[model samples]
Target chain A: MLSIKDLKVNIEDKMILKGINLDVKPGEVHAIMGPNGSGKSTLGNVIAGKEDYEITGGSMEYLGEDLSELDVDERAQKGVFLSFQYPVEIPGVSMSNFLKQILNTSRKVRGLEELNPMETLKFLREKVNMIGMNEQMLKRSLNDGFSGGEKKRNEILQMAVLEPKLAILDETDSGLDIDALKVVAEGVNALRDGERSFVVITHYQRLLNYIVPDYVHVLHEGRIVKSGDKSLALELEEKGYDWIKDELAATV
Target chain B: MQQTVIDINKEAYQRFDALFGSFEASLNGQKSNPFHQIRQSAFEKLNTLQFPTLRHEDWKYTSVQRILKHKYVLEDTSMTISSLPEVAKMPDVDAIRLVFVNGVYQSHLSDNLNQVEGLSAFSVEDAMNHEVYNKVLSSRLTSEVDENTNPFFQLNTAFSRSGMFINVDKNVVIEKPIQIVHISQSGDSPKLSAPLFVFNVEQSAVLNVVESYISTETNSENPVLNTSHCFYNLAKQAKCNTYKLQKLSDDHYLIHDIKADQDRDSVFTSFTADLGGAIIRNNINAIHGDENILTNLYGVLLGLGTQHVDNQTLIDHAKPHCQSNEWYKCILDDRARGVFNGKVMVRQDAQKINAFQQNNALILSDTARMDAKPQLEIFADDVRCSHGATIGQIDEDAVFYLRSRGLSRRDAMLMLQLAFLQEVTDFIEHNGIRDFMVNNIVSSFEKIV
Candidate 1:
């Protein structure tokens, strides 16, 4: 569902992601583990088409079409979702209104009929139940005063409503309690299907316990240094990134 | 222009001197009093002071260059209210009705809301002619006179022959609001309309006053100068709420002066709405007479086309433990212009005074302009006073978030604008007026959308 060939990205004059290549097929959940400054979030943001990062070289393709040329909203319409590490708080825009706008706009792009206010309200009730979100959250402004866990959960709820083809959860495990982590992972697992995929980016292997990945990639700097299966997550949790760095140093 | 000013200045003095000379002969020296003499002295003092030019500090934002060019005819012609251009139809006016046309009173169309007991309304001419009305005008106008930097007050007093005055007796609370309506039918011809309001509330008396200015006739592209001087005197522990809605024709020019004196423990709240006029200037002053008084001033301006609106407010904390608040918002579309200047002055003996001023504006179009200056002068050290101003366009992220939900770009923009203005509209105390404003806003939004 997603492919990247030596994608080099720069923010300002500094290089953030240099010569990185990766791929993920449908129904596959991939986890990328890296330490601080490993470009883990940068890779996800670039793929989601955030305009801040300049694509210096190479290309990124999603479902066999070029993704680098698309805008953030256009990418979102094509079923590419990004669970921001820090979701922006937009005042004066209600959460339900924001969610309904995104869902209907995305559906319209896919040739689906628009939903009335009543239909949209009913649609939101089921998704709210799935994430265990209070209905009051919909009445308030978009993430105006939400807690860290609530913001994360709100993102997951949006993912469920949009039903994107590929969702990149950028450090969704950070700043969340254990119970919230469990709920979020469960929400992600519920959305899993044969035609959908996910790229989970995290610093620890704790989230891997909930939503086990089919492929584990060790990202050292900007490139994937090693590729393995679920056992790799357990290994990294025990030894940390130092063990992988030592191994890479020896190989170099 | 130098030669022209010299000639116009001399002519102006001669014109006024001849007119007052005729009035003095007609009165036969009947006007005699310590306060009336003081008013006459102030009127004399105004003859030497020039009508403010653009070079003046207070008049810098609003230009009256065109008014200075034409010679205004001081006439006694009365215009019927039916001749006025219709906007929002006036509500059923069951209260006291005060009417002013071209700065003179029309007693035929006015009714005294306080005809029963402790309240009374009268025209200045009748007040000056009859002993009863003369006593009320002389006592109220000269007693609460604000002898400050404003020259318009002196100009109005000097030129005004007839004014309307309303007084609520001590300890008497008026149930219905007193309505003062000034209808102008002056065309491109230079005109001066000096309408006066005087309210004296005794201890514990409550009063609500709603005033409006509407032009009856005018050339759509020309200017008509209209001036007003209003004074409110609230005794100790008295409370008053005043609202001034300016919906005059965009072809009219206005100079409004509002001054209020609040006694100890008194409270005053004022809301001014400016949605019309080619050039509008407001000078509002509030003075706390004793300790522990509260005064608030709120306003909103919606300007379109080339209309110009300027609001200048001054809050004077004269005694200890006084509080004052001011907030003004302006939304400008097309090439309209808006200016706001709010100043708070805390006197030397005023300690523990709390004052806050905030001015915000939204520019809906690229050509629209807004300027805001919040000034504070504090002579006391132990006080908490703050002021801030912000000017910006619509929030892009907020717009995108709404657009992503399914609303078209236009609908989303309209929703954001409505939300931005909801705070000020919430302050409207009259449901009918509030709904009328909302309907106008929605209709205008359709064009902008």
Candidate 2:
């Protein structure tokens, strides 16, 4: 569903991501674990077609289209979702109105009939219920003045509503409590159809316990140094990223 | 500095002088009555207070050269209209409508003043004969001449014979808003309409007024210079909210001035929405007459194409324990220009006063310009006053955030701008008027994208 080969990226004049290669087929879940400044979020943003970085070399592809050619909205219209690490406050735009716009637009782009307000409300209410958000939340500004957990829940709610093909989860568990984590994980797990894919980026392994990954990749200093399965996440939890770094140093 | 003897735009000033000369000449060389004295006094004052220039500190950003170059007929009487224009009517508004076409009152199109209880309305020329009404109008007129100090104010006063006088009795609340529609239709050449409106809300009375300035000639080439001066006098414990919307031909000019006075324990609020006109200048002033008064002034100016909208507001806290709040926002697109100068004055004796003023603008195009100047002059040691101005482009982060959710870039921008404007438009206290204005505001922003 997604492929990246030798993707070297620079933000300013400074290089951030050296060479990187990744591939995800349908229904596969991949967890990218790394410490701070490991370019994990940068990879997520680049995949989502954020226009800040310079792709000096290499190519990123999604569904046979060059990722860089598509705008942020075009990629989104094609079912690529990036759950932000810090959700922005969309002031004055209400939550329900915003969601209805998203649902209708996404549906229209997919050659589906746009939902009427009533149908849109019904569809949104169902998903909003799945995330356990109150109906009152639909009236407030989009994630504005919301708690950290509510923002994450809102992102997850948007992902469920959009029903994207490839969803990049950027530190979705950073500020969430264990209960909120379970709710978020459950929300993601519900959308885990056989055709959908996820690349969960995180700094810790706590979230992996709820949303178990099919594969785990340890990104160290702009490079994915280690790749393993679910037990690898468990191993990293018991030890640490330094455990992998030491092993890499010995191997070198 | 050496005084250059060739110091004025003499040609432009002479044209107005010639117009006034013809107006007086047509009077058959007979100038009688106190009202004519008022007009004559204002005419003389207008020469001294000629049109403001760029050198004037208050008129720095905006030049009156366009107004000066255009020739106006002083007042247009050639309009023989049968029906009111559709744009003057607000959807679902049950108002006591008063229609004035080319500054001439349309009796057939207006509500009968005698039928409404606790309400008195008359033409300004007729009001001069009524003893009590004359006092109410002159008190404000005399003070404006002494203190307001605006050239447009003087110019409008010279032609102040054109408007209406509305007075709500003591302890009475007007059940519905009084809608005053000024429809500008061009005459033979270019024309001008300067109507003076005075509204008196007596002690403990409540009044709601919605004023609309619209042009019947939509996109016509012959532009009109329409000037208006409205005085709102709120007696002790009175409440008044006056909302104005100016939508005219893009080549037209509108200079509006509003002076409001709040007595002890009274409340006054004013909202203005400028959607059209090549050059629109709004001068709004509110002063506290006694302590414990509250004044709130809010506006939203939307400029598209080459439209220029300027709002200059002043709130004077002359008494202690009074509060004033001013919030104005502008959205400028294309090569349009917007200027906001909101000044708040707290006197030394006005202890414990609270004043807050903010002006924000969203400039869409790179060539579009916005100048926001907020002035707060506070002398009281115990007063609280904070004023700020912010001019910025649309928040790209918010735009991208919306666009990434599958919205087109245009839709995202329109939504963000509407949301930005909603913060101020939502403060309209009346629900029906607010909804209508907000809907109009939405449609206007949609056209921008």
Candidate 3:
């Protein structure tokens, strides 16, 4: 469902992501693990069409269409979702209003009728229950003073409400406690309906145990140097990322 | 041949001088009235003081060249209006409506004074002639005699022919608000109207006043210039809330002066929203008469196009244990300019006073400008006084965050801007007025950016 061929990206004059290639089929979960500054989050942001990074070379395709043609909002409307490492705290827009706006706009773009206020509330309440978020939180501003765990859980709640075709979780488990991580993983697990796909980017192998990726890839520098089944996660967890750096140096 | 702004201003002064003569002559038998001395002194002060130039610190950010370049109809005859303009209508607000067209009170459109209990309304002539009301107007007018006095207020005092005198009896609470609508309209040249409003809330009384300024026509070449002033005097333990909504045409001009005094344990809260007009200025001053006064001065402004909104506020703590809170927020876009100057003073004997003042501004366009100055003077030994000013742009990161969630760029910007203003509007306890103001402010902001 998603393909990247020799993709190169840059911020200002500095190269962040060097040449890389990857592919994922529908209904598959691909976990990319790397040390800090290894371009794991850069790849997710590139797919989400963030404005800072310039795609210096190559092409990325989703659903047989070029991803560069869509704006950030257009990409979101076309079912490309990115769960930010730090969800922004918007102090004026209420959570319910934000959720309702995104849902209705995405629905209209996808050729669905806009939900009435009652239906929207009902839809939001079910998603709220699925994520175990406080129902009263909707009355407050969007993440104005939410706890770290609550912020991560709020991202998952947004992901559930939007129901994107391809989701990118960028360090979603970094700030979560074990219980919060369990809840977030369960929320993601519930949404894994055969056709929906995910690219899970994480620094630790613990999240893989909850979501259970179909494949694991070790990103070093900018390229995906290693790819294997779920067992690779256990190996990396035991050996640490230094094992991948040593192997790359020996190969070079 | 083109005329310079200087020559146009000279012409304006000559026109004002001529109009003052007509005003004095028209007083007829009332030339010996008690207020005549106040008018004579004000006219002398007006002539002694030149029009404020940019070099002056008070007028540093705002230039009145745009106002001085035109000729106004200072001696316009009476005009007839069939009905109230749509802009002045408050459908959800149940109140006493007082309409003024071209500075003359239209009794036909206003509520009858005899119908309302514990309320007395009179014209300027009747009030100045009244023995009891004369002292109230006299003490307020002659109290401030300084070189720093604004020439516009002096102009209003010198030439104003029509105004209102409203009094609330002691221990009476006016259930409905008093809505004062100042409508400026002219079929020919730009008209200049100065109307005065004097309000006295007796001891233990409660009153709410909502004053609005609107123009029927919005011609850049022939807009109306409305120079109005209001005096609010609250007696001991009295409570008064004054709300001013200035939504004149974009080309119109308004200069309003609000003077208020609070006696012991009185509470005075003011809310001023400046959303329209080419150039508008509001000079608000509130002083403490005794101990335990609570004063709140809150203002919100949305400036677009070449519109300019300047709000100058002063809260004086003269007695012990008085508290004053002030918050002013402004949003400027498309070359609009805004200015906020808030001053809080604690006198020497005013111990244990708590005064807080804050000014926040959001500039949407790069060309949009805002100048905020907060001044605090505390001579008292023990007092808690604080002042702050913050000028910022729309958070680009917040915009990107909203856009990433499927909102268009415009929607994202509007959301952030609206949120920036909601903090101040949420303080309004009246839900209906808050919603009405929010709707109007949002619609105007949407049209700009």
User: Per-prediction DockQ, in order?
Assistant: 0.15, 0.71, 0.71
Worst 10 residues of 1 chain B by lDDT: B80-89
**Residue pairs in steric clash, candidate 3?**
none
Write out the backbone clash pairs for model 2. none
lDDT, candidate 3, at B388: 87
lDDT of 1 by residue, B225-268 (tens): 67778778788999898877787767887888888889999989
- List the TM values for chain B, per candidate: 0.86, 0.95, 0.95
Give the poorly placed runs of model 2, Cα more than 4 Å off. B1-8, B25-33, B186-188, B218-221
Measured with DockQ on alpha carbons, how good is candidate 2? 0.71
Which 10-residue window of candidate 3 chain B scores lowest in summed lDDT? B140-149
Sort every candidate by TM-score, greatest first: 3, 2, 1
Backbone clash tally for model 3?
A: 0
lDDT of 3 by residue, B1-449 (tens): 89765666577778788878877877798778667777788888887875777767887777787886666666344565789987787767787998888787787788876478989988766788887987887777766424337888888887777777899999999988888898877557877888888899999999988888888866687877888889899999999988888888788889998888899999999998998999999999999989999999998999989889999898888899999999999999989999998888889999999999999999888999999988788899999988889999888788887887889998888888888888888777666667767776787676764
Q: Whole-model Cα lDDT per candidate?
A: 0.78, 0.86, 0.87
Ranked candidates, highest DockQ first: 2, 3, 1
Model 1, span A114-221: residue lDDT tens = 899999999998899899889889998778899999999998999999999999999999999999999999999999987889999999999999999999998888
Model 1: docking quality category: incorrect
